[model samples]
Target chain A: MSSLEIKHLFGLRGVSKHDIRLILDHAKQFREILERPVKKVPSLRGMTVVNLFFENSTRTRTSFELAEKRLSADTVNFASSNSSVKKGETLVDTLRNIEAMKIDIVVVRHKGTGVPKFLADNSNAIIVNAGDGAHEHPTQALLDMLTIEEKLGTLEGKNVTIIGDIRHSRVARSNLWGMSTMGAHVTLCGPSTLVPRNTDLMNHVTWEPDIKKAVANADAIIALRLQKERMDDALLPSMREYRNTFGITDELLECAKDKVIIMHPGPINRGVELDSDIADGEHSVILDQVTNGVAVRMAVLFLLAGGRNNENA
Target chain B: MKMRKPSSSEFPIAVLKNAKFWNGKSFELRDEVRLTSGQNGDTIEYDCKGALVLPALFGFGLDFMEPLRDDVYTCADGVDAMLRGGFYGGLYESAANPIDDADKLTAAENRFSSFGCLGSSFDIKFLGAYSKGFGTDSLAEMMELAESDAVAGFGDGNGVIPHSRFLRLAMEYGKMTGKRFFFQPMDKTLRHSGCVHEGAYSDMLGMKGIPRIAETIAAYTVLETARFLQVPVHFKQVTCGETLELVRDARKKGMDVTCDVGLYHLLLDDSCLETLDSAYHILPPIRSAADRDALWQGVVDGTINAISVNHTPVLRQDTVVNFEDSVPGALSLEVALPAIWNKLVAKVGEARAIELLSTAPARLAGSTPVANNVVVFAPDKPHVVVESDFAGHVCNSPLLGAELPSSILAVYINGFWKEL
Candidate 1:
């Protein structure tokens, strides 16, 4: 397929496998372009893309901006802190004003779930969800998938385990949906208090309460950041207790396969979710995930903006 | 049918010919009937062939947002939706504008009363706030308002009353005054900002779950407190079947407790959340299918006493947001009767459904029946639920664009027969 079945990259829940394959294949081509001496592409030379971040983000925003710049698209950054959004302008009104500026694509990150779909419904521009409150981070998941595929050759029949704060991570949700679609087996490991309650989502994956057992058979283990506010919410006891229990340390890796890769959707709570060594070790592909993020995003932007692969260069 | 808006209290005395009604078991036909008025005002006669005549509905625990001065719809739109749905009277919640004092209460009552020119004196009553601005420190200045003409009952209009010492004192005060208090059973901490029922569906959708224990534990506490104090209480928006077991046991022991469920709760469930349609984002979020079925059983076995339309009118802009951010409630009054009829009345015969929708809620609201006030609904008259069909401004509704199997044809209130 030359194009995606879906017009908007809302989430991966209902995304077809064929569309995912197409995006991944194009991402591979983009990754090759990224390594070239002259990396910029003129595909979207005249098109304007707006980055509407209602919530604060570091890497995801920077990665998307870098990808937009690399694709030669005129990028406008709209941050909520200094924008009219803080002046009591509603989301729809702000979007209408942006659309009035003739923007071609809208990449939004909102604290509210399903905001991407909401923007897509209200405006004419193509929507890319950078992250939507605990709902999904589609591009992040796409990059994770691309990283896994690059290292392991294919996602089919691979065992991918995700640990810590499974209940609230948009990264885990998107990864589960996207990775599972590519025929990978997903195992969720976390404190019992943090597992998503009574969900059929558990039916699609195995739940291992023991961190060692969870990572034992994994081809890749993703350690999610443990937010400190969870202690105030009484979702956890303390960071020390969580680290001792479920954190990805070198000691915990002894039970895992030798080739088992380690990943984190970053700004990692180093000692809390992953040890420094585990995050930087030979098996660590954390930085690779960030690099693939730009390429995957380029593929997403190109696909949604209706740019063909080779024609984009 | 397009209705000619009537001035308040200017109802015409008319004779409805060949009207049919549900006599418990089936639809029974009646010959010419004279609907009279206290004042012999404008008299208009009309033939009501093939129409189901029933008492105008009195909704309980109903809510309409405080008028948004800049928005398209206002409090009058809510009144129009209720009247168009065949409701003559309803107990309005003071949620949007908290009623902590006599002034706010009187203002709210007067504001609702002003819409009387559009419909019959829409007997809108207000539930006094449980505490001062819903604070836990002290009870609201409702001791004086309780004796006033405007107070429907004592309860928090917007949220659940925390099980604090303040709640116990409020219960004692309610007991001393011999007034009914409404309890919205819930533990907020346990609810954890969940917007959907805690279950398989919420898990799959990655939305936070509102566990059933949040209602059950709070309900048990409320039930025990009311029983101990010998105070009469009513549970509003009871959504779980587990809570029903407690209510049934309490009633069996004659604890002087009663409960009502949202009209939409019986018809929908958490599975509907899969669509992520913000319209289905209701508070005390639609529970599991098992809970929906249990609610039906509660209705049949008389465990659930009445149905409230909970006719909340959120602005069109507020409802178009994401599922989690979208405000709860749908503009239900315009489509309530048809939805209830197609889902309930048609299958179980009209008497029981009418009792749940009209008679029971009226009794709960302590309304003395109006002799001539009646609704003429046409079950065979199919109509599409559209924005233009609403007497109010365009608003949010789950039933919009829906094809309902029935429609309300006209209403006779204050001796006037208004075709709708």
Candidate 2:
């Protein structure tokens, strides 16, 4: 199989179907490695990876660290709050200093859009976007895609509904591009205030303000977390009203097809965006998404590390 | 006001031979238009082969932040830059610091007159601020300011007054002075700290979206008020399709309303934000492709009267920040003409472009195109826009590094001809 030829996973907006399949195919191998007792690979033994997160994260950082360790690659973790960034160092300066140490790749997460693209343009090392503001979160979309493909077989002709604050969800943006590119009909469902008006411009993507109508015939339902900070901006009336209007309950699942997969990118607001029972229910693949994240990221790290060899080939 | 006869002794007569000249209405090929020499200098003949000589371009609602922000650019700097871009005159809005009192207005008038006497190849007509400090509630010394013959009209620069009643009151007061009020229509609440146009691009780029409704709603308010009050008002730098329709409807109703679009808005769309480049960041924001096409339609249908540079010179450092943090406005004074000729003239035709750039603006400023004020340009010449080519102080133009398809060859103003 052809390997992914990209140096960075900035977003899924421009990633081709073939490259996505290549990433998924490689992820299968990494998933098998995760099941092994030793759970280690020497594919990236001599390589170095750095987790440079300007934003706070728990699961993504730990997941990346574990993935790097599992591949036998040397890893460094730098949180912006404690680093020289607190001493007024810029994003470029911090990355440049890290690059001076012969780093092979920089996994970055920032609150600013296109930060990874900026670094990828300026630095020689591979730049992987963990998450960047409301722009994109490609790896999250890839893991979610991997989970969907695992549960529902081929993505083509499947109906997938993404419900939440799409205007602020980088996850939603990336998945909109990814799922549609994979030939799935994607429906964006949320409050009218939270859903963007021009989603019809994207292929195979439609927006519905009503949650019931959006999930009625979907084969897969991905519920996004409702950020509480949106209250301050007056984007929402209140958490109680939003939960009443858009929160996914088990009753809501009855609207979808039987055996329809339910997913959420984690740290779920137990009773806000989704019901507590449903989050831990049979249909929910929340934990599986986290498990698949490691394998998907491992595939990403492996393919990008092998990019030079693939280019020469 | 008495029109000055074309004095042969006071103004130099230059024979422009074999050129296409736009004479307020349409382009006509002239074999020779003899210009008599003033006592100051000898008349020189120009063989304007294949050159298009048009009435001097006037920048409506132009801002030069002198006196208040003299460190950025002075009046002389603004005049010199306009001359370089083939413009011989502009209606100067009171910007940064409002010229509210008679003394400040007279000072500005004297400064412009002195600049004119220096043979600067360009003159400025000042628009005294309608309200003190350009505030929404308070009125300035409009009648006294109008006494200075140099005051062309009254404007709040690009600021939209927040209160409708206050705006009506200001217009009522301004009506007595017989000066037209110039304002940009925008609702403060809808535009609330937003930087870019509200659309898919703004959502995807994560920039705050300022909906077209912000402008449309405000335009409706202004048009309704102007219709009711029966006071002449000019809307400056109008951007959206609905606003143009509003203007068209107002004119069909025979309301004395005229509107102008910014040169940047006519040429760019919201897609420029995809690059997240701060250079494209501007007030009122470049809108969607549909909005852009509608703006061009507005131009074609005669709904848009004139085009302004809306030129606010920004320092290079101010533009290098994050897209949201970067200041709005562009250094377009020096590049407006060539950029427009390259981007617009072919689609709209040369005569119409000249009307939008010259006649309409001069008429709005309550001035007629004088015989001596003219620009000669080659419409087919191509030149890349670089920072080095600009004579202005700021280099924050979005068209920097672009190859434009026209160049200004010469400009005649007052009693002198400048070969640019």
Give DockQ for candidates 1 onward, in order: 0.53, 0.32
Off-target runs (Cα >4 Å) in candidate 1 are: A307-313, B1-11, B22-26, B64-75, B97-109, B112-120, B140-152
Which parts of model 2 are misplaced by more than 4 Å?
A: A5-7, A37-52, A68-104, A118-125, A308-313, B1-18, B22-48, B67-76, B106-121, B204-206, B342-349, B415-420
lDDT by residue for model 2 (A268-297), tens: 998899999989988899998998999999
The local distance difference test score of model 1 is 0.82
Model 1 chain A weakest 10-residue run by lDDT:
A304-313
Q: What class would a CAPRI assessor give candidate 1's docking? A: medium
When only the first chain is scored, the TM-scores of the models are 0.97, 0.97
| Candidate 1 Cα deviation (angstroms), residue B120 | 6.7
**Colliding pairs, model 2:** B9-B38, B13-B35, B13-B36, B13-B37
lDDT of 2 at B391: 53
